[model samples]
Target: MQQQRLPLALFLSLFGFACAGTARADAGSARLPDWRVSGFGTIGVAHAGEREADYTSSVMKANGTGATRSWSTDVDSRLGVQLDTTLARRWSAVLQVVSEQGLDNSYRPRIVWANVKYQATPELALRAGRIALPVFLIADYRKVGYAYPWLRPPVEGYNVMPVTSSDGVDATWRWSAGPVRNASQVFYGHSAVPLVDSLHLYARHGVGASNTSDWGALSVRVNVLRADITSNIGQDLFDAFDAFGPAGQALTARYAMDHKRMTLVNVGASYDPGTWFVMAEANRAISHSFLGATRSGYVSAGWRWNTLTPYVTWARVQAVGATLDPGLPTAALPPALAPMATALNAGLNSLLMRIPQQTSFAAGLRWDLRTNMALKVQVDRVTPHDGSTGTFINPTPRFVSERTSHVASVALDFVY
Candidate 1:
């Protein structure tokens, strides 16, 4: 629909200001640029019980069971490297790259972040370039398996929005008062992601804000974001729809994804005292087009005993209607075209079912093998909503009934 592009002038202005300000602020400091390199990875194996469909982590992946007919390492395996350099006392830069299974089934390296940061003061900072989209509580570290207690974030909520990185600028403010720390961030950016079957998503204009509060072992966070979305319905399909003339045009106007706005809201709370922890997050994603709306959340609890921690989690996602009318206006059309209209309506209904609606239960254990490495084993039982396939992709024809999938995974996560 609507394509929004970031202007090169905006990036140039931000970059120039940071470099000039840093040079002036650090004129007296003799410290040279400091560089640090670190890496993180996960080696994992996964199997899904469903034989008719592939249970995937996100829309970007084509891994899992079904036609693969074998355990998939691509489901939970990735390697990432990060480099951070201090250009001056008040300015720094970070670049992070990750290699993982991608939409094309290749282990291509993707630039997740490459941003220059300027510390305006002790409590205020500004950054511009490619930055991670903080759409959820753990958005910054979602790829770093070692950062979270679970082997992976619950797909029910995390998989709703697949765009990972945004090209734009953001400002963060941090302060502390009476043992309580608070941080607020505001960002504006644009991103694009490719999905299954030649589906491409373009997010042009986006703006969001998040607030986090930390009080000892207790923490809370809330975030809200809105973005304009544009996606292609495939060239062949478009041609066919166009052939139907005015009726097809009307259908496209109602269903084609172009220039629709999507909104996301998330809230989370966690309590951790080293020995035991409980965390919960809730999210709602809505789009004005056929992407429809979904509500999802997860609750997890874990207790640590020395180097070993066991956790249990429950998660669920549900569809909240596609905002489509149940009755089609086929009666107003010519009798000869009525049948075609009915068929088109049926296809539209089938497309709307793509929205995920499922529930999952998981139990896992994390063993800290070393200071920066951990071993994890997790199992999940997922039940798709009646007659719905949930997040699984490439469903076998006629296998449209409700079904359950059991997944087992083991991973070694390391960070340095």
Candidate 2:
């Protein structure tokens, strides 16, 4: 794996070096007509009513509100700066860096986008380097808090796939059909992201396509993606299973996260007139490994009263495949190994319980403080179902799976 990553690491290093050199070269010049710089940030805090588990925005975060802390800024605080430059009439480039709370519990600046684009024609464009994956309707702007009406996108649907970008190439074509305008994109790439517990998620041989259409105030999108994913999140547990001979091997083969294939399908739509807006999205994840299969969706609507927008959202995530598996009949084992067998079986079942099955209802109000700044306050009632802990992390012994948690959040978003 290290060898495979060498090329990408070298490419990124060279790209950064070139960009830095360009900046230094342009410093002596008075005006840079081809260069543009912009930035965005969010200052936020959240508190979760449940004390036994932490409520995190995504698995990439190490800790969040509730048990970890009374109020946490890691759930939403972030800063991003982007530089765009036109290299030529047909060539352009963009570099964006973001600093946010990461799985290692640090606010490290990472490259969110570093892509060069070639304008093939009036309606076609090609790009190479790290590009954002268009997995959902608002995926391209999900990190820009000021661009959206909610404090954050619904976690139930957005957190299913934590990956944000990939290293590869993509092509986009835009055309107008009658009264509707359409944009279609096709991409191929691979991604690797670090997670908590020293685990890493890798998606190889990823391919995807998406299309979006806009007509008046209405917009709709559909996307399909597939990849071979691997993770070592539960290495210790799987290693123990490997010790139990063929039965244990079979169990590991069925549940281990070893180069498993996963497919994702997403459909979304939105309508925004001047005074009001409504948006909804649905996602389906198919996998045969321990990740299982899931159906998730969310619906949101808001009324714009002057500069204040009040919005309500309902979201749900359910496991559609088997959440638990009967592994190795402990009773059939030898008397001396019965205890160990039973323990292993219990452990396997416990791991399976991590699958998310939850429902959330949220209401928020966004106050547009200025044309470039906004303040938001939101409250969510989250309930775990079917003994799943939902998206909460760091569960303690006192954690109850079916318990409901109420979270309150406030955020200030700005762009400049």
Candidate 3:
């Protein structure tokens, strides 16, 4: 793994973020009721209209029915808990925990966020420790709204670069820009991402920054991020496609390539004018997309008619194979693959190209039953652009998929 650490000196200077004003002060500050706790959870079920359409996590493959139908159910359901306690006159501590279907069906607990702070002032925060990245303006609260008309955020764009947290120091500065409140962030840090068997990400170095503008119920944000890949991150996936051969030289041109840098720049906007709302996000990555240079965008609109809200959303994503070593499998099969390679190629050809592309048309409904709870239902038509007529090529019948599947998802969300 590639290893790089900033001098402990920067740590000394960044620790103990000092804020300007004290959230807890006077009798209110020292009151015994100084601590507050809240929690939220979701229980939901969804069915894909395809027998071979499996659920979204790795766990579904191992534990679920593992069938062409009713395969797995881990999508919109999640749980979270947060606690805030005042530490001193103007300092405090916050901790949050979340459990959800993540990274391949491994139900893991992510600290989500745990930090100590000195509120030197409300307008500015000098926070250190492990801080969450402020990628999208709503990225922080993307999960809290079962009240959201959509069963989930548009995945075509949001799913491209979904990183949870970073280990580093961050500065959150909030001020006013005319009628809007503005928040900006700058962060430098080391991210410890689990290997998950990918050779390239066995370890990684992450750096990113974002800016947000909030005017009334509308907010807009843009972010830029770059990651330096120093090790063999995800060679196995290539191996799956027969990219690597007995000769390791097939992997990289340089004995060691310079840190592979992945950069992302995204712009997102959302507006809620009471009874009406509109949201759109567009992101384009350069030399760092899933296949590199992937382009994705989503647009959604909703209207509240009393307690019920109806919405529609559209999204598209495309990734072409450009960065990979063309000499590998898709380009030429190694001798070891021989007959199996021939069979694999034949089967893959029958299934069409695997260049990643997705277009979705979704319709959703939301009902607010109470002040703290809401019910949401969404149905989406997801079309995979690989041109494979159906899921699971006849050869790999085990890998079943529906060429087109209607996904119906429903969930209950609440915070108390």
Best by lDDT: 2
Better model by TM-score, 1 or 2?
Answer: 2
After superposition, which runs of candidate 1 have C-alpha atoms over 4 Å from their true positions?
A: 1-30, 195-199, 234-250, 323-343
- Using all chains and alpha carbons, the TM-scores for the candidates as numbered come to 0.90, 0.93, 0.77
Q: Clashing residue pairs in candidate 1, if any?
A: 1-258, 1-259, 2-259
In candidate 3 the C-alpha lDDT for residue 42 amounts to: 75
Q: Could you tell me the TM-score of candidate 1? A: 0.90
Most TM-score-accurate candidate: 2
lDDT of each: 0.82, 0.88, 0.60
Q: Which stretches of candidate 3 lie over 4 Å from their true place?
A: 1-33, 55-71, 104-106, 195-203, 230-258, 287-291, 320-355, 387-402
Tell me the deviation in Å of residue 54 in model 1: 0.9
**Model 3 vs. true fold: TM:** 0.77
Root-mean-square deviation per candidate:
3.4, 3.6, 6.1
Query: What are the per-residue Cα lDDT tens digits for candidate 1 across 115-202?
Result: 8898889999998888888777788898999999999899898988777788888999999888989999999998867455567888
* lDDT (Cα, 0-100) at 389 in candidate 3: 25
